[model samples]
Target: MSSTATTTEAAPTVELSTLPLRGGEKKAEEKAEEYKYAHLLPHFSEDRYPPLEPYKHIDPGHRALKHANPRAFLDSAERVVELTPHLGTDVKGINLANLDSDGRDQLALEVARRGLMVFRDQRDFIDRGPEFYKKWGQHFGRLHVHPTSGHPKGYPEIHLVYRDGNTSFNFEVDDSITTTVWHSDVSYELQPPGLTTFFLLASPPTGGDTLFTSQVSALKKLSPQFVAFLKTLKAIHSGVEQAEFSRAGRRGGIVRRDPVEHVHPVVRKHPVTGEEALYVNRQFTRRIVGLKREESEAILRLLYDHIDKSADNQARVKWEPNTIVLWDNRVTAHSANVDFRHLPDARHGARITPQAERPQPALEGLDLSA
Candidate 1:
């Protein structure tokens, strides 16, 4: 990852009173009712992205895996290879596209326990087109439409992360779009994705490996006092504007829905596992609600640093052609390596996001002070 200095600037202000209302547009009162939390939306400076602190260091010595027990849920037929102690497992001998009802149930249980599962040398889903890919994701839950990325025609649920010769969404063109920045997919949504699966159609011969980290491990490493304090906080997440999508000139089935902004707990519970994880990420979490600007910046920076610097909590997966990687968004954060940008055969892949329940803090019965 490259180090670039980010300067802090005042956020741009928007005045609803000065904007002209179009014909047939809802009245101000109706619009207010529709978007009741519009005032909480984050405003970024033209040249800046939120959570401004960059990763200070990448430590390689962190190798502790917390609460990972795949054998407890997986049976003998499933071959599980642990990629790292903290997160990521490579499952062999099972084809996702050809899974039976019993196999599907067992796979889901393994994924929830492992946080991420990688399957290499897969041909069943790759040979089929977008529809087959969509079907595989729907087995888990409803697919989510990305606010900015392009999807295949008639398929709003699939986002194409391609860079073929004729592709419009080129990864090399923009420095702002690198995947090295750690984030959970679509954390901006009111109900963020429960799971995200990526299938690599074409990958470079070398480079473009992705890094996955466990947020469950991240929270566990923090002091109990700080964890208790984090449970009491919420953070704001805002969606990408339509104009931003237009400027990129990427094509997909646009939903044309109103922009979204919402508040979510800083510490969120995994709906399936019932475990607590630190939820605020570098990508979409704007600020800690009700905190002073300076205080919010300081605390957010500290948390981001902890997530990034904890080398023991991450696993690196190199992409292979016809490979599929599925991760639980509620428990993990990932970063993609952009080292293959100069290669003529650009990396191409498809991503599917499974719908998730709204985030809630897991503080019902646990003793925080222990």
Candidate 2:
């Protein structure tokens, strides 16, 4: 293995405290304590609210290039195929496991321009183990440690996602489970993940395709008046409120940390591209701050419907073994297609989320409120 890649040969065992607490295992005292202090934590914090700013669209030329023959922009060294009008690109002829510093830097720039990028035939990645994945993730930023789904053995940043037909550990339990719906990865954290990369180890014959939609497109499609309103809003995102870990029971590699919640801008500006994108997601965003519950729900429902139902904003990736997908979580929302649930070992993959700073609205000084 190259120095840039990390191996799992000396993988360490995850500590028991790091795993999520199993159902019915919490003592009565712990339950009593939780009830006592739960009310003290405000539903949302005002300090985290985003400042209202004038609405202005900064059209980075990347979107224009995407519309005007995206393939024509590809360099000779790599074949870049655009997957959708707004998001997703397929990059061919680069081996992820062996990428030098310069190649990795170029790949990052492409992902910034295109919300999501896919690299097919990454069999060498699987052979390199969890360390290889971790190292690649490190190039962008610090790796995120999932609060519920614990990291793989030695590499504390890799989230191991797996499903088998016989087990109850599926993505969605019922239609009511919001966590299984479309969402940006770990939006509940104060510093949500900026980028995520997933490598498929096993994929069923058909199905298990992941869909990604651009938040940039989602924001642009809304009425200008509504976009102005969204700039002044903040939403509460919570991991404990969603309660996926408690409902699903204790599973291996699932860390049992205390639930965390944070307030984030409803519309965020991408740090690198300076593009504005809708930050609220169905899975983690509990409610919009400073609004009546009814009003918030109506507005959120409209935004959610726009994001999930819009075909023009989406790009779909059909997973195959040895395939790798990288997406900018800051600008994209994704959902896994569970159509192959009936098949044993339907889908399996490892993911790494790179840490990012708090989100800020991308409002330019145009005074659109008038």
Candidate 3:
């Protein structure tokens, strides 16, 4: 599991003539057979962020969590700790790429009330490269482009979290790493992200942590009559297992924008602290729309076992090697202990979500039958 020889380019080209593209962004030789091992995601031509043309994404919200400054954002925090009382905090002297725009609107309201923040000596904010990680996540909105993650070659908006994952297509001797699913990133996007960002390139020498929870504290430990029957139900977020794990090519073969589903609102309403969460996720939530498929798999397996057994609205982070986490893909639901990546020991990172709109409904027509 080792290789480092850069300078064998070719493969990625997108001349530009979009009238309707999206079959892997058209013409790498006309959908080049949906890329079968085309250097496992190698697309170039001095790409300045290529392969993104379809539009209609809209996140235009979170106006600095409504004019920032919660005491100059806790006086630019040089120590904040609150790793849980409903999700993480850990600040210690700000420098998230030198904020200030009212400290990035109070750091987006302290990541929408601590849905997870933590940031330690980010080696000078990742030595300021990768376009400052897509310019500090486009200052919070419209940066998401992960349809089977893998980036950092002309910055396809930097989203590549590989612990040998799809290492040029499944690098073997897979010992085991995957602490059972929990997600919120591509909520089967119709704009499904809200201020994410997890940069930690390479980490080990410890059990690789990362297991956040707190979907607004699992909707306040459920039962306001079962959260008004889960905000009048609706949940079917599917990118079809990222299009069958990138056409069964696993992780890196990317279909970019094909497998979509979007139904949302199994109680999700936090476009910047409108609160109310628990947006069903055992990875892309696939059920409970109008129930009855055995009641949507017994109410999505009892709300994914009440947000994976709340564990007092969990939080575990513990990463290093210039760490940095941001979290709050509209509430929280992460997972990846990678159990130290089967001791192959090399859990990489580079996420940069932003999208954030399209998923509201905290109770549109309330007055539940109680």
lDDT of each: 0.61, 0.63, 0.63
Q: In model 2, what lDDT does residue 324 have?
A: 78
* Candidate 2: count of backbone clashes, pairs at least 3 residues apart or interchain: 5
Reference-based TM-score of each model: 0.73, 0.75, 0.31
Compose the digit string of candidate 2's lDDT tens values, residues 1-370: 0001112221111222322334322332243243321111111111122322223222222343344343333454367678987799887766777766555655665676789998876778766776677787877777676654533444556775545454322235455533236889878876677667877544456666788889999899989998998998888898874445534453432334566777788888887678899998887898888889999999999999998789899988866546778888888988866766565532445777777666766664422121
**Model 2 misplaced stretches (Cα beyond 4 Å):** 1-78, 168-171, 175-180, 242-244, 247-255, 364-370
Q: Model 3 residue 337 lDDT?
A: 52
Which residue pairs show collisions in model 2?
A: 6-131, 19-255, 19-256, 20-255, 20-256
Model 2 residue 187 lDDT? 86
Name model 1 segments beyond 4 Å from true. Answer: 1-78, 164-179, 241-255, 364-370
Against the true structure, candidate 1 reaches a TM-score of 0.73
* Clashes (N, CA, C under 3 Å) per candidate: 3, 5, 4
lDDT, model 3, position 364: 81
* Per-residue accuracy of model 3 over 11-34 as CA lDDT, tens digit each: 222222311124443343453344
Sequence-dependent TM-score of model 2? 0.75
Model 1 C-alpha lDDT versus the unseen true structure: 0.61
Per residue, candidate 1 scores C-alpha lDDT tens digits across 215-237 of: 99999999999999888888887
Q: Judge candidate 3 at residue 167 and give its lDDT.
A: 35
